[model samples]
Target: MFVFTPTPGTTWNLTVDNFTQALHRREGDEAYIHTHADAEGSYGPRDEHDWWFAFSATGESWAGTGSPAAGDHEGVALDEATAGAAAEFAAWVLRELVPPGAGMEYNTRVGMESGLPDEVLTENTVTELDAVFRKHLKASSS
Candidate 1:
């Protein structure tokens, strides 16, 4: 599991293998890679993001409802760098959880508030997220 504050009022919590069993039960395949993030509360001059993704040996897919769907909200609150950090963490987690693997792909939507540009927000988010991912990666390897 991974958790970080992208903004003052918003926190993003993401998990990869935590739902493996649930995916198998719901989709009938253990080879699936699943990730989900839930952002609660409006925070720090920005909106919230809540999204999910599931990939089978078949192809890429997303989870949730609506025309755009909740998954479309994946990185709405993040800048590109922070979003990249989040995406990298998700991808790495999927790769770590599944072996004999193929490449991965994803689609994400971000919500931007604040006069600040995405590049700025992303850089800051990335700095923090990179540390978090590295910590989890080391622990998982051990």
Candidate 2:
């Protein structure tokens, strides 16, 4: 699991295994990846806005916004089990999550506000990653 807050108004939580399950359900295979976007509410500066994307492995490897007929957002299930699909998805996330030149700004802001080292922030983000994923799983399963 991994969590990242690229902007004040958005956060992302990703899980490698549950994502695998979702991908399996979507693609009818065990070795595939999935990506999805969720509309989550924002607080602070961007209060009342909807922004957030949570991607998990489901058996697909495509990307898009909003919900799809299969589910929400976009996903793609690759034919091969190579890391290329995951790498491409991650690259897309890195590009989409935070715009260029804003990384430093957000880092400084969050650093000062939290009064924690970058390592701690990274750890917290990762912790929240699985937490959110599990919550979603529980909800869907029920």
What TM-score does model 2 achieve against the real structure?
0.23
Query: Cα lDDT of all candidates, in order?
Result: 0.33, 0.32
Candidate 2 lDDT tens digits, 1-142: 1222333433333233434444355446433332323355222212121122323333444332222223332222222222333333434344443344333111122233445322212222323433433443344345
Our tally of clashes for model 2 stands at: 16
Cα misplacement distance, residue 118 of candidate 1 (Å): 20
Residue 124 in model 1: lDDT: 25
Kindly list the per-residue Cα lDDT of model 1 for residues 15-94, writing each as its tens digit. 33333443455567434341322354332222223333343321334332111123323222112333334554444333
**Cα miss at 122, model 2 (Å)?**
14
Candidate 2, poorest ten consecutive residues by summed lDDT: 43-52
Pull out the clashing pairs in model 1. Answer: 9-43, 75-110, 76-110, 76-111, 82-122
Q: What C-alpha lDDT, on a 0 to 100 scale, does residue 62 get in candidate 1?
A: 32
User: What are the models' TM-scores?
Assistant: 0.21, 0.23
Which one wins on TM-score? 2
